[model samples]
Target: MDRSPLWDTFKALPDTFLAYIYAEKTRLAMAEESRHVVNENQQIVAGFHHGYEASDDQYHPGTFQPFMMKGYWIPCSEGKLFQLRQGHCSITRTVEGQDQILYLVHPKSATLFAPLISKYQHTQVDVPALALSSFRTLLIALPAGGTTEFAMVKVSLNEEIGGVRRLLYQKECAASVANSSVLKNKQTEKFTCLEENLSFVPDAHLIDPKEEAVQLSGAGMIHRPVPELFTTQGHYIIPLYALFGINNWPLLNALIEQSQTTPTQFITGALLRPIAEEMVDHIYRQRFYLEFHGQNVLLKLTMDHNDLPAIDFIYRDMGGVNCRLGDVQLHQLPEHLRGHAQYWEPNFIPDAAVIMEGIAKKVLFNLTKVFFKSEPTTRDPEFCCWRAKMTVYGYQENWTLPGADGRTDNHRTRHTPKTFYRYGYFEKIFARELLEVMTRHGIFLNIKRSCPDYDYSFFMDKIGNIDSCNTPCVEFEWFSELVKMTLPHYFQHQDAYSRRKNISVVRP
Candidate 1:
């Protein structure tokens, strides 16, 4: 397989290479276990059938000629390969002589559910091909082991559904992108379906009809790079989790130094903030929610105009994304996906908030823990104190209902800003910072409210409601209060830092 110089460079990085090795070892073990279980199950079933004199010939008699899904020919001459084994659902191999990677799906793995609702009562699932004319993104999905043919089907269906999502998201956010700086600064790439006119199918005879088959043929997606930053050479792409590896400390320090920024600043500003902004903006404007966990998101490191390291994020594996079609026009959807009930939600704010909370708790907080583990000197005692204060006093413990009835309801029962503070100090600070940034972009004011008369009391009254039935009025008011609550902590941290520097602090 022809290898890109980038791949060679990737392997040369001691930390990244070690991380890859560690992850690959685990993946190989899992794959082996999966294969073993499959084979064992097949044997047990076969033995049982033989006892009953059941013929294997009853099922898929003779040679099994599988139905082929049409896809564009992505020529990978000499079958040269550099494979990425980090993914769970599919394995990505670099396409030779092209700026693309092919995702070979795994059969008998996790099902890829199509969010589009149909007449069928059960959820629909299939693979779709994804054709990206631009940047590449990496992500890990659930692992499954199966036949190459099944992998092909999964890949095709995933790509097809993903392609539709990309198209709709781009179109829906087009006008907003032109006007919103948050959307403009945040980057994503276009995806389209491979043309049906093209004819390309892998050989079916490579697998024995009787044995468990695991080959890398049949259906797959040839995706190009997604982020424009990726198109530039010399940028290193690393998954977020990889940074947590023990062997990657030196690389992390080098990145911080190259960025000409402190570890805290680099992480909060470059990594956490950008991801938060993009996610919030997408949900607010496009009603599109992504799975922004560590494995699905990657960091692209390169240099900025100041020759300092610039960090950007890349996302992939859109199969699990959520899109609320309550306000969306049916005409905006592809003809085939129009009536899918799975994509429709009466109210999406509650779910969006949950996604935001996940980002704070799962992604940002975990990242901070790893960074602090690696760079203990960068820890801020003053910041920690401020975080603690916010955790304890930043949220309302109870909502006092109207009428001198002395009735007070615990706020924990609701999905309010207070819900975020319960996680820990990191979540408290992250929520504060994220809300601060979001409010600056007028998110609170512009968000679709559940009630026009929404205020603090109205919000409190509707607490603990179902997601589809809950009001976002509380969210709007709570977000505003949360931002206000951050001012004191921000100033306190700033004052302490300034004092330590023996400099006079000026309040903004």
Candidate 2:
């Protein structure tokens, strides 16, 4: 199909299962592609700035969730490439004052990505493209073509997103999936879960030293507890609130919903369908009520038994963080839900509206970079409306929640000072919004005719985290709905489209 999307996400599945999926998928055909952070244990180990050590295995202590650390870069000399054959990490100097984290990484041992710390022998240089911030720094590296250079580059990790690395993994998944054969049957679909929420582990999926084929690409596939398809995977976890804050993610709330069940094989895109052009306004009013430049909003793309196509919309962000639109009612919904729930989903309330105003006054115009390195120049045009409003920063990688976040450590959070994520109010907000959409824009499917044992309550309870987690509960409803609104159209589209094309049509 030549469908190499820029990103790939297979709902929620374990690392073990992912391996099998990858193998089967590769056997089918294809190619591939993928970053990192730091802390206290990192300083001591990297031999610079503050160090980080294993805090607790539960909080991803050893190789916890993808994270960030603020430390100085005590360079041995002025250089850009401090090649570390021992570990796989990168370094970025904070723009002037504001410290920003970048790339993605495995949550194994410390050194995820290095940040500019003061501990190094630094000689300032002017780099134009670098982000402007108070960290007044530029990446230090050896003046190449010499007796090779090495030092403990003050490496730090991004809280969870590990920026660049996260995107890389998504690229990998997209790459892997594009190679699948259209004729591949469901039984032979063989594909793995390329989850971004993995942890660090010793001797895990570390990349090789070959500079050309970035090894960091495979970092997310390490040290997680799951049954196989083999090949380990890892993730860049952060507060659920961070995920909810923007539109640059898969179904965040869906992740939580799926986690509520008995985890099975990893699966994604099996539930929801892609958004249609007609619903752009609906999605815009909801998802981009702010600015979801690259948000990944997904819809239910199946068809009805009568050969009709359907579309259902939901926020692609972690599942929360909507203020402008929470109060902005949906005129597109059926009359019943449009006016029935006068009280906006109790959870999607924009906390920033009230909580951040006072704090906004205290913002350091000079040290603003310390907090938002990229804010000074690339600040979103919409953000001015809030100053003009105000703001913030995902989920369980930091805390516990109702469904999935409850399994291992429901309350034992690793990061400090309970932000929106630790409390899970962010996800709470997204969940509420999703429910609102389902109530308003969602379609109905009579599962009783298809399967007498269909379970609506179970499916509604858990549908997004992973297909396994919620599939058993609502499979009938979903399938019934699938048959009723989208499947036939899907086949027709593929069939008609394929027939006129050169590819041969081989029905199973």
Candidate 3:
């Protein structure tokens, strides 16, 4: 018998290389098992079959009910494939005990998504290829490099969605990513740049031949699998969101503290400062906006001696990105980004002030506040607090004031007095306790305390000076009141609300 090509290659290589090939073969076998189509009618892929429970008794109250629905497994540039839903609803049945519940997907959502997916499949939308209708089925390409474990693990996570809670969690996260994208900074490449976040949608044409409306299955709908499984260089790196969310706080903290120095050093020295500086400079100097809220950010913790957390700062959705294209040097930007600017609708150009406000809202309020407030106990509350505090203050000193006067960059357009009047409230109380907390932490032992001298009154005056004819006093009051509700108090209110809701019976 003739020797196989793989065998011939193996024989020509060193003996050590055979072990790698053997491992590759093993991985391919597992992937083949996973991508196998279990139910031809439903297009149910295999491997996930192990997680399926035949009886409702086996499911957690929090798990989405298990049922087979029409879906597709779209392949990434890396050999991995993610299952996406077709014809609107991924889950097609009502819950067993709940008669009021009809379906997981709304009719309106499916109606809107169907045409979008079809258009992507047939036409070039300048969007990610996942929008295409033709990308279907978990096709396992043999001998593909890298461990299939992450892809399989993702599949398992999808499989374990057996309760309503799981469904809701997925829905909420997806919605958040979608909504946050609209708030991203749209500034051109002269001063700011961002990663485009994209989500998976089922090509109904490929997955649903009958073109029937997707019904809610007690078995939940499959969502687009995040392609973050593979890095830009094609390496696999797990995101910190998974560890933090999966109740692996210990692992996260341990990784943070693994170095000889404190968690603050690891965060500040290795990860935080560089990114913070870049963001602040761009926002303040160029008036380019961003929404780097934690969910959109991914952190990769190394188990090696280096103790590095490789931060993949991804801004996936483009809808919220606000920027002044006229101020940007478009030629300096890469090709795809150039396409983004060229393809953008002409009317969507936001005012310079609006982009600055977006930075304060998304980056400062949403990212910094939420992180420090929610996970205060994750590391030493002191460390998280300082890091968060410093981040806010650094932005103000380095970017905010400088950008107001065009001091950050000579080429950048400075914020006009009118623009300052609109956005001054943000500068006034940004990270309200940051300076006070820094003093207490002794982080300012050598540095002079300048918070007292900072002109809070000027910003306050700007706020009051706004003409009430166009900008209502009520609107300014609402903004002030909203900012006053700091993250800690906001979360406290949420906890109280949740406690009240969770109390099934109360005695009078």
Candidate 4:
């Protein structure tokens, strides 16, 4: 609970900034606390905790574990260090006498992996040092309400292809130092292989933390913006939006001024492109989906040789990622960690599609709304034009009046243009762009059937239902045609990019 070391790192920042972080953290904690309170009239919503509902009864009930309020300290090979409670289960520790950091997970706190840990009797699991370093660095760079320590020392680009860069950062951890006493006696089973790099971010689980034992967590390489990677020119990382308090408007303005690019170009190229590309690549190659909302995503801005802003993204919180199981080789995973249903999905396309929708609605759409100064909902001329287009495109039908017998009669039709305006121009545009991106990546939209036939009745029933509307159908059809026209060229470009960088082709 002693966060002095972490707080000291932010000494360069103003006290008001620290106060903002504290206020934000307190507000978030309060909000989470309120959400966890279930009234007597409310039903016990299963799997609501951390957005995961247990498919099996053996796991902890949904009513338990209220927002990771508890933090535990573990005795490791080096010694006992203070646990820095993050928003979730993971914590960071500084390695003494070395410039390194280790990310450790309290397995019990991670609901997804808790069953596996209990079944295997594992003591502790090691998160990727690089990933942890990246996570820690990102936390410092974009100080949210959680733990803050300058864990990352330096970051360097491991590889770069087609403007996307693979970053590597170093941090200091106590476990990274070799224990001569344990090494000489050959009792190294309790020590983790700190140097092993693997793909896939794991939900680390542990048992009996007081015991002196360390186990390697499920391993895999994760790509994207994380932690501390800086250039000699002092390039810094900032979140697309703050976790609390301030907004990204000023930052966006500064970035636009510095890059000398219009807001549209910067947003489309720097923000949307990276996110869409990463999502598509992850689904296609890695067989996983990321929650690329504002908080989980960060922007790495630096000046290029031409003084234009070179933008990259860093994604954190691997525990929330959903993996596709059917295509993923489970045999490649550790024996103990195999067959967990929480993270892996047999049919993952729907989940991935939903995540894409979230990015559009939660991240891009809101961002555009902020940038354009557009109203939340508009019933203006543009909206009317969009509705007309939807009707012409067969996504909406002419309104039919209800008959005296309380049935919809086809004979009597009325075109009463209802003032139902939930989407603005920017929202529609972003939705269409998202569909285009999905189409390019071979992900076509498949709207579920709320009614047997998706007809006028369906549209009427879902008039105000933003989540399920006919908008996607219209956009999908439009983009599908466009993609069809450019199918050959798209494949050619994709193949060329793959050939240009083989590693980038297969990486997330």
Candidate 5:
């Protein structure tokens, strides 16, 4: 890895400053002296003779790949070459004799990746090109170990709404977290771990000296201080559609078999129960609710004490966080973080039950039950019974809200006047349905049920001309049947929306 060229360019700039960032790299290289290479039937063969994990045979590279130099460039749609803006340019070459990709970003964009480029060049001994795509002529390369899996490159087709501006917002949000009190100090091991897991995308700058930028379309240089953090890797994290797809059978089968043991279960039980409990606790205690969607929720694997594969979870993309407006005790937080807590406003505070709705729809129904329905091995009554049992267990163990007096709360939160009045009949019915299913599974036989006694006829009687409006509760009703089935029925309703909605997710 060479930094002389980039460093020289940086030094030549008129004004520049260092932005503190964190990077880490770990690797194990085999001894060159012990390496063996052979030509079998004209195919090059090489193998590791000594290592923790040894292989008998591996493909050997027969060609050399060169790094991109100062002059190489990717041409725009109009055939004009993209030039380096400021000192923000990176060169990455493949290891096994592949094409080199050059990333040239505006000075503003560079801040998001500079620390990463420096880390890769220093640690990996080569700035390897990752799976990155750019809509704006200039190529972009994400920092290694960062969540680049969700990176997407698409043509902006919306005529009325602006895509670039939205991306800028995401950038600003990520930068906000990066510059927050918790991250700026970077003195603790937890912060180090967080840095390794998260990737940031800062607001992009339009660098069209000739007035020809792909995303900007000739908009002059603009600077925004927005940034976004992406945690889950798109490839490793199972997509929400994978529930409907057939290719997920293998993983589903494995998880079903593993579910017999509490430590190894992937879908529900021990793995998901505690996390859901944490989410509920966060909402009541910290007023922060996470968007637990399939795209946001990743299925990760980690080894347990016995060295068996067990499920783990990672959360990122703080832009989806739902905040509640109220007084919060911030004296315990760092001096800088205390100020930030006061500045942020609650943007999307839904009925409290919506949080549980999202968790159950995504984790319980979409991720878990869909697999059993799809896979032949797990589609039996036994699997359904298992799923039913786990559903009750999960809610009882995690979703219980304690009253101020401290008992089980006995579903008091669901029946509160404030909740029902604020959210209307839709939320009330949804909450009742959830409670009924849990009760049917024998979750709260001992505690007096607080679910309002409302039957299907009650809903039918109340269903007046209110169906004609374009509001959230009515919109939710269109797929109430699917909700009754405990699935993400809202997705079906979303499909029929008259106006387009942006449900953006990260990708690599």
Candidate 6:
């Protein structure tokens, strides 16, 4: 129980942070008054007490152990001299004391902590020191209290991704439906990755020293406008992976859990933006660099998307058995030197790391207002970072195709597609299996008996009397029955595909 949460950080503030005045000292004093010191075995270490719910009839039905944050202790004051061996100020408060800490952390200042909270909730991992430091400017504000000397740190709400980012800024778009369409005026845009000094390093040679080697990183990115609106009368809309629903990706889910910088956790661009990212050089696992534009500075980070969340990836990069040339990521093979061992890593899933090439699509989504704690990486299992639980979905996209108007070079337009995008699954392999299971489940029997001579529509009249004087088919029950009967078999084939499959809900 004393273990720190994954993604939680107890780091010393950076030099730049000590000079930044992010909070008012007055507010800090108000927060400290809420604190109380209780005795634990004749010693004083801060703590909190609360009535936890446990029974179904009691409006609550769960057990809870109040978490204690891992905060650094500075005995030499001046906020310097971060003595690690000194002490840790935890959330271990008495009933009289709420989340008050060694010093008062502003309530609104809580925005800086959204990302750290989201990360811990999802994977139970404490973030690295650097991650938490990025948002330290918004952490607790020290108070020179009057009669009592107490530290009141912010009480993290343990909200989903939204709560994490809200600690840093104003309203977050992802957490609230009202803020969802905030960027209606901003149109999406696209940017391409400058060509890296691409050299087809021989299978037996590593990347040699070249001037361009400095530019070539472990990751790359391509940016483009968000996907054109799926709806009409469209305004600039934000895209979010969470909106992807059951048909989403493990990578997207992971991003929602990691990022605290922006409101992207749920706010996907109305259109898509293809972004290229670079990886850390020479790490066995893939690492990437993301550029975060802040008020005073711009920063780059080398990280693993699997380790951090909110990674912007192109869906087109993912290739399956049915992927097309235009629908894949275009990642040049790294200089493997020998046996191309790097290709065998997990980043090569869904075929290969093929970034999209030629007439491609791009989109954008953001998770606004998340503040993740980036602690130092350690082998300790309690605070070690990990990716979110992964799940793959395959479903046939039922959409219309755009007409060939050579002047208009866009697949996603205001008009509906006249046809569907045919890719990502093999009908021949699984369709037959579904047909057999469906037959065994007594589907064709009803069809055969109802319209043995003609198609099934004719028997609709026989199955039930149309309540209206001029209607053609049977009752709604007929439709529901058909759905319940065939859907199981249809999904069976669908579940087999890690990418895409059409449920045979099609009635001829």
C-alpha lDDT score of every prediction, in listed order: 0.36, 0.24, 0.30, 0.35, 0.30, 0.21
lDDT of 6 by residue, 1-508 (tens): 1244411221233323222211111011100111113243434232111112212221110111122233321111211111112222331222333221122122222233333233233323221211111122223212223321122121222122312321211111111111111112112223111111111101101112231331132111111111222112212111222222222233333443454323221222211212211111101011111111111111111135444422232121100111111111212212221112122234322211121110011111011101111212332222122100000111111111224222211122121121211111111112223334335555455445444552434333533322211221122223223333333333333344314333344433
Off by over 4 Å in 2: 1-127, 132-209, 212-426, 442-452, 459-508
Provide the global lDDT of candidate 6 against the true structure: 0.21
Best by TM-score: 1
Per-prediction TM-score: 0.44, 0.21, 0.34, 0.43, 0.38, 0.17
- Estimate the TM-score for candidate 2: 0.21
Cα displacement (Å) at residue 324, model 6 = 31
Which candidate do you rate higher for TM-score, 2 or 3? 3
Candidate 1 C-alpha lDDT tens digits along 382-453: 444433443345332211112322221112222233223223334444555665665687554433232233
- lDDT comparison, 2 vs 4, better candidate: 4
**Over 4 Å off, model 1:** 1-232, 245-247, 326-329, 340-347, 378-425, 446-508
List, residue by residue over 319-417, the lDDT tens digit for candidate 4.
Answer: 345654432344444333333423435435555655665564445434533433321123234444544554454433222222322122121121212
**Residue runs of model 4 more than 4 Å from their true location after superposition:** 1-6, 9-233, 242-247, 326-328, 341-343, 374-423, 435-508
Residue 183 miss distance in model 4 (angstroms): 31
* lDDT of model 2 at position 305: 62
On TM-score, the stronger of 2 and 5 is 5
Two-way lDDT contest, 1 vs 2, winner: 1
lDDT of 4 at 175: 13
Q: Comparing candidate 1 with candidate 3, which one achieves the higher lDDT?
A: 1
Off by over 4 Å in 5: 1-128, 132-166, 174-244, 261-266, 270-272, 305-309, 323-344, 351-356, 360-365, 377-508
